[model samples]
Target: MKRIFKFIENNFFVIVILFVAITLLYPNIFSWVLGKVHGINIMNLLLSIILFGMGTTLKFENFTEVFKKPKEIGVGLIAQYMIMPLLALTLAYIFKLDTALTAGLILVGTVPGGTASDVITFLAKGDLALSVSLTAISTVISPLLTPLITVLLIGNHIHFNPIEMFISIVQIVLIPIILGLLVNYKFPDFTENLKDYLPAVSSIVICLIIGGVLGANINSIYTASWIILVVIILQYFIGVALGFVVGYLSGMKMKQITTVAIELGFQNSGLSTSLAKTHFPNYPIATVPGALYSVWQNLAGSILAYLFRKYLNKEE
Candidate 1:
């Protein structure tokens, strides 16, 4: 048993892939949890735990890194905020996706960077500090920016409470992240030593979130498979391209370029899902694109990270 757990710890990505596959295959498990789980708000609780774990991984350096390399972070932030939303809108129109799904896609695009970006950045030999800063700033700014952008871009298609959405952001994202940072500051050694385990726990939580959502809406994805794939790919590519374009235009280095690209390509789908459920309950389907993107982006980012690592080894 100990060996099996250690193996899972060593190959976290493979575990994530297997979890997602199993969840996708047996979505009913998600429903069972939702049905059996009481007022504990299991999903939200798990998400909060994951967010807290994320905070433990952060430090003041993450934020200060922005000042050291403002151009790279700025370009990456612009690409992340711009590319995905535009692509979401365009894809919605082209695919003529269901109104609820269109709004969901837009929400997914509008969301800020996720904790996963930092992991991906590290694995790809990109700029960890820049990714952390970008994720932090984008997230802190989300309450104001995300709601406004969502209202302007997608509110027409779905009803939402910007205020409620903002509140949810505070509860689920900002507050937990702040708490995690405080915990890290208060107990630096523990956080540092426990870093390895955090990844595995985070991976498990992420897979659970995806699984729960997929299980809850398995039929929707099955029915809209092509549209979902198209939107996910479009969001990823546009994000990657825009990140590189902006980084190069700003004269960032190769590593910075890669960091920006990965950061821009992936987003905090968990936040999007929470907002969709809280603010737009009438249109639960609006969370589908974000949920699907969560699964797809991790897979694509893992492949990209592996390829980049191999290429860098050859260059050395």
Candidate 2:
């Protein structure tokens, strides 16, 4: 079981890809996982579980790290909120995606950085502290930024209430994180024991979320695969390029630059997926980009991390 879990952890992106492929081929197989009861979507429950796991891994020190280096964290946050959303908007227009795809891509841009960035940053010999701090701070502020940005950019295309979206983010994200933090603080030893298994569990939950979304929208995804793929690829790579530019122009160190680049490039697509499913039921295809991104960014980030590590090693 340990070896099996280790394999899953190491090949996280591969598992996601395989699951997504399988779902696309056999939609009903994974589609059943989207079962709901009493008007509540099962994805909401799974998302809460995923967020709770994320909360357990965090510590008070992660928050303090932000204050310790406000300049670095602030720059990272600025790049995150500014670069990605605007780039997404540009790509959406340039590609001339319909309202659903445009909103989906923009939402992906607006959300916080994923924990996967921390892993990639570590692999690239980047500043783990900055990565964690960026992710934590960005996540903490997502309730305000994500909905506001969405409304500002894609409001004309979609009819969503920003207040309701804010409340949903708070309920799905902030509250779960706070609960996990309290548990971690109250039961340090127990949390420590659980931490080892959290990654594997979280990876499975993420794959399930992707599979559910992909299964639900298999037909739409097939029809729009090329356009969505092109836009998502552009969105990620552009964010990476702009992230490095921001860090470089700001006089950040290479390690910090690497951290910023990964942080800005990768997003918490899980949150985006949940938000789309919960809030924009009319546009089911909106969840497609998030599901595809949930797989693509990690694979791209991992490959980039390897190259950065190799280059850094040679320099040393």
Model 1 off-target regions past 4 Å? 1-6, 9-13, 32-40, 312-316
lDDT of 1 at 87: 75
Q: Per-residue lDDT of 1-316 in model 2, one digit per residue for the tens?
A: 7777778888898898889778877888867556787776777777778778778888989998867888789899999998999998999889899888888888899999997898898889899888988898899899999999999998887899999999988888899888998999999899898866778887998999899888888889889999999888878888998888998999988888888989988999988988887778898898888988988898899999999888853363
lDDT by residue for model 1 (1-316), tens: 5455466655666766676688777777765433325555566677778788888888878877768877776777677777777878888898888887888788888989888888788888887778889988888788778888888897776777888778777777778889989999999998887676776676777777777777777777788878788878887877877787777788877788888888888898877776676676677677677777887788788888887667742253
RMSD of each: 2.4, 1.4
Off by over 4 Å in 2: 313-316
The Cα error of candidate 1 at residue 238, in Å, is 2.1
Best by lDDT: 2
Model 1: weakest 10-residue lDDT segment is: 31-40
Question: Which is the leading candidate under TM-score?
Answer: 2
